[model samples]
Target: MDTYQTMDVAVVGGGPAGLSAAVTLARSLRSVAVVDAGEPRNAPAEGAHNVLGQDGIAPRDLLAAGRREAQEYGALFHDDRAVTARRHDGGFELVLAGGTVVHARRLLLATGLVDELPDVPGVRELWGSSVLHCAYCHGWEVRGRRIGVLGTSPMSVHQAMMFRQLSEHVTLFVHTMPDPDDDAWERLAGLGVEVVDGLVRMLRTDRGVLRTVVLADGHEFPVDAVTVTPRFVARSDLFEQLGGTLTAYPMGAFVATGPMGRTDLPGVWAAGNTSDLAAMVAAAEGAGVAAATAVNADLVAEDADTAMRARAERYAVA
Candidate 1:
């Protein structure tokens, strides 16, 4: 039942986006707090790519560095999950799993999305390792190697094309995805990509390392890495609790926001995967900064109005 002082801003989910926002708000001398559940979306990935000045850094290490930087700027962090949220007294209140309550004038949800991998066997076990998505994230490591794209959705064809740019040895396993159109088949053939038509039974692994893709028809193809198109579902429980509806997309669902991370919910904002499903680590960080600036500006306007009202009252009293 411990309650914290009402902060200027409360950021939920302490990943790249939340931490960046915390740093920015703290630098602006705004009282800010970050609540994290400690389960980062990229925790399974060995390294994050495309992050400038710290490319290929491990996900945990990057987050640790972000936490340190935010702390250095006087941002308070709670390593607990925000279990419940409700609007309160012209602001918002969040109840943590540990029983602490956080009160803030503004709420920012940087809770990243969850990657729901294909139901195929071995995919979850090897995720973030031999099983991967996003050509920009782990494509370089598998470059010039035997890369297999698991067909789970129409986007699987697009994935094959993306990986073809990185590796000459690319195979598209048409497991469950719809048959490619004539133009898609022609493009794949033009790129010399092998197309295998069969239901993928499982991904064969040896000593926890992926070795091959096994088909239901008893055929197996050796591969160095497999790509999948996971459905990206954003973490939006708290947002929903606050009466925010998730915007559905063909690939997944997310909380919709404006360019500056301002959500439709009043006094509530979102950044990172919560709003932008395609955002990478660097892009999430940028979104967080943008949301922080917007929140700070909103607060500045509110403060000015309050001051003006106070001055008017003072003159009347005099």
Candidate 2:
């Protein structure tokens, strides 16, 4: 705990959420530190979209810009992960992946989620390049190109429909699904999508350009781009380790936060993807600002409470 002395606030993760939170807190004159593992989920994406003022920006570039903004505003950036968080006396103790310990009066967990992609051939190679997940991010670029959406969730058909809006050609490959509902079938029919019954054996390619899909039934569906709707697992185990409860969902999950991002933890708060999975870049920036404000307010209250108690004690002594 004494390794870094004391901090006003400590933010975990380095993606949109943590970066935004650190920037907001630092701008507010708080001595803030951001602990990042540098493993962003969208690292493989070519660029991100639907974010105000930063639409179509590359994920890594955006993160770098965020780091600069936060650092310039007095946020200390560290290339480490907060592997554990435990409650301390009126503060928090954070242990990084490298065994570095930092103590802070308040904590902000902006650790984002991780997506588990399927082990299809050439999938990882094309990730963040030609193979994308979010339609709002990459659909426009791949429009009219042959697109394939692998079934990974109940919302997968819905994602395919979104892609269909961007392209005339879409195929919803029925892979790794126990059974798709009638509504899914209906959506596919309405969107005029090709449905492949056989499992996806592998993806054929041409020097990083996805060419075709080899199926189980000795068939192939050639595609120029592939969209996947992966299941997101919230990387909030550090918070969970401290008995922090969360509301989990299929596509995403979030720690329950109040108006200003205060969770049930006394000296701990949350912002960004850790608490609001739907938050984009600009929105997360605003969220980080709000959460910092909330944390500051809590500190103010504690200060006031201490002062009032001391004044009362002095009068009692008199």
Q: How do the residues 1-318 of candidate 1 rate in per-residue lDDT, one tens digit apiece? A: 889999999999899999999999999999999999999888988889999999999999999999999999999999999999999999999999999999999999999999999999999999999999999999999999999999999999999999999999999999999888999999999999999998999999999989999999989999999999999999999999999899999899999999999999999999999999999999999999999999999999999999999999999999
Q: State which candidate has the highest TM-score.
A: 1
> Which residues of candidate 1, in runs, are more than 4 Å off?
none
lDDT of 2 by residue, 1-318 (tens): 327878889888888877877877787788988888898767767677877777888888998988999989888877987888998877888988788898899998878777667777777778878778877667788889898987766766877889999998999888875577888788789879988887888888877678998887869888998777666666878889989876877666678888788999787788776777766666676887788788878777887999999999999999
Candidate with top lDDT is 1
What lDDT does the true structure give each of the candidates?
0.96, 0.81
TM-score computed on alpha carbons, candidate 1: 0.99
For model 2, state the Cα shift of residue 171 in Å. 1.0
* Per-prediction tally of clashes: 0, 3
